[model samples]
Target: MAREGARPAYDPAGHDTALRATLQELRTGRWMSMRRLLTETTAWWQWTRRTQVLATAAAGTDVVRTWLEEEPHSVPATVMHARVCVERALRAHREGHPHTLDLWHEAWRASHTATRAAPPDPVPWVCLMALARLDRERQWAEHRVAPPGPMLPPGPWGLLAEADKRDPYNREAHHRMLQFLYEHGTSGRLAEAAGYAHWAADTAPPGSALHLLPLYVRVERYRRSGGRDAALDLHWVAEDATREAQRALYAWFEQTFTAERSLLDLNHVAHALWGALQFTDATRLFEALGPYWTPQPWAYRTPDQGDTAQAVEIFLQARARCRPA
Candidate 1:
């Protein structure tokens, strides 16, 4: 049987009819086979030659589009295609290759335009990062302007901070609120983050990372001064967040570490989780650090007090000490 979205396999007997129907379909934007329409995997060098030719010939036209649709997950293939197109365009621009930049720019605009027209539902954060960088580069190449940072949604981190001062320990509320804060914070929603933080602090853990996060160093002074309530409050805040937020951090951490390679090398996540008293997730991460340990490195700031390495160590230590249940 013929494939689902393909034209009937060409047959000499029906050549005239097929030709007439295909031509008519083309005029209406109906492709013979969307899957076979643009196969970029024929061979890398050969593919580039064709892409370059198509781009050069179709400069400033919607020749290679289909990718901007946000219906599908942000697959690596889409990212790679965008990168290849951008690289070729930039190279052409730099080398003064005839029509190279124009073709590349055309392709870039087509894809990005498509992205904007129907921005991915989840907004394809990573791929959008790539697009953002590409736009910044292209702009600098022509207009010399840096792209602005991503726009965020509102959150309540500030309010929560104030509330935490009035009542320094409230793990359950903190966990729930922090969950909403972090989730919404991704969209640059500060008001939402602040509201969640306030709610979280309203009834947060007794002593956890949530409380110690903003006061890692200063709180240490309180801990050393026999301020048991303050110290324990800090402890509960960290631990509670870790345990509750384990899945989110776990997904990210597991993406990086493995059983054979304890995150002791980086330690930040582990430490943060440990500070939150999230020994269970930490232990699981330590034990499953096998092939899951991605050789690719990742680094990011956390809570301002400790780095990734500290986070890892703190968690590893916790994992080591926890009695198996």
Candidate 2:
């Protein structure tokens, strides 16, 4: 059964299809394929990480744990196990399920094990950062921490530093660190997050995915403040704060635009532009995306609404506005 004007749960685009096949390979114990898929290229690790997270969220933690048990020293499997644990913890928190702290600790232990197994792999360290964020949130909620400081202890920053040592340009590592700092930084200010985003963008090499950092911060800001209408506030758009965000977004789009690699970023950029009333620019992204919609930026826009419905509505609206007949 299908709802009217609703997008499917998962759009079968080329990348999505590839990810599904890769997950199948992993589930089938195709270690060689998994290694080649994860390690043979740059930025491919992001897809691996994303795939594991999605698979774990959709399936369950036991599948990934079984994969880990099958390959004790497998870096990919271990990292994925850690990621699955972290995702489960986050999901439990969102759903108000019990034993979230226990899940967080499990994620921490798994990430630590993965880090030990593959000292040079940044993926495990990225998982540590995620665990650290969860732990920090737990501490804040429990202790009611005072202002001017995060409840984070020393370990997470060390993990991020090690990740940087392993891969100075690790996009996921940087993004995770940015999220950690943005939420827990002493000032708790969007300006601080923007500062980190701009610095990362400036330091990154040309055509680097780090250019989307500011857009990430902007999306976070929008989510924290409110949904679509709040994001579309004239004052927020006209303020000096968004000037750099817009510049960074357009720069990323101009320099490193691709429908293939970072479709998630494309979705974010489209959402940002649409909120800013840049219908034409948003339309280009919608065209590039075609029917393959990532339910993130749209989902965030309307938290109470179904993700597929929200995504479909936004996509159709952008298409109509951008391609008026």
- In terms of lDDT, the best-performing candidate is 2
Residue-level lDDT for 207 in candidate 2: 56
Poorly placed runs, candidate 2 (over 4 Å): 1-16, 24-36, 39-61, 137-155, 186-189, 228-232, 235-250, 257-260, 300-308
**lDDT value, residue 73 of candidate 1:** 45
TM-scores vs. true structure, each candidate: 0.29, 0.76
TM-score of 1: 0.29
Write model 1 residue lDDT over 239-313, tens digit each, in one string: 544544453353334444232122222233443454456666545543443212221111112232325454333
lDDT digits (tens) for residues 65-155 of candidate 2: 6766777777777777777777887678668788987887888787788788877777777776666656555363322332223433222
Model 2 alpha-carbon miss at residue 129, Å: 0.6
Worst 10 residues of 2 by lDDT: 140-149
Candidate topping TM-score: 2
lDDT of 1 at 56: 34
User: For each candidate, C-alpha RMSD in Å?
Assistant: 19.1, 5.5
Give the distance in Å from residue 92's predicted Cα in candidate 2 to where it truly belongs: 2.7
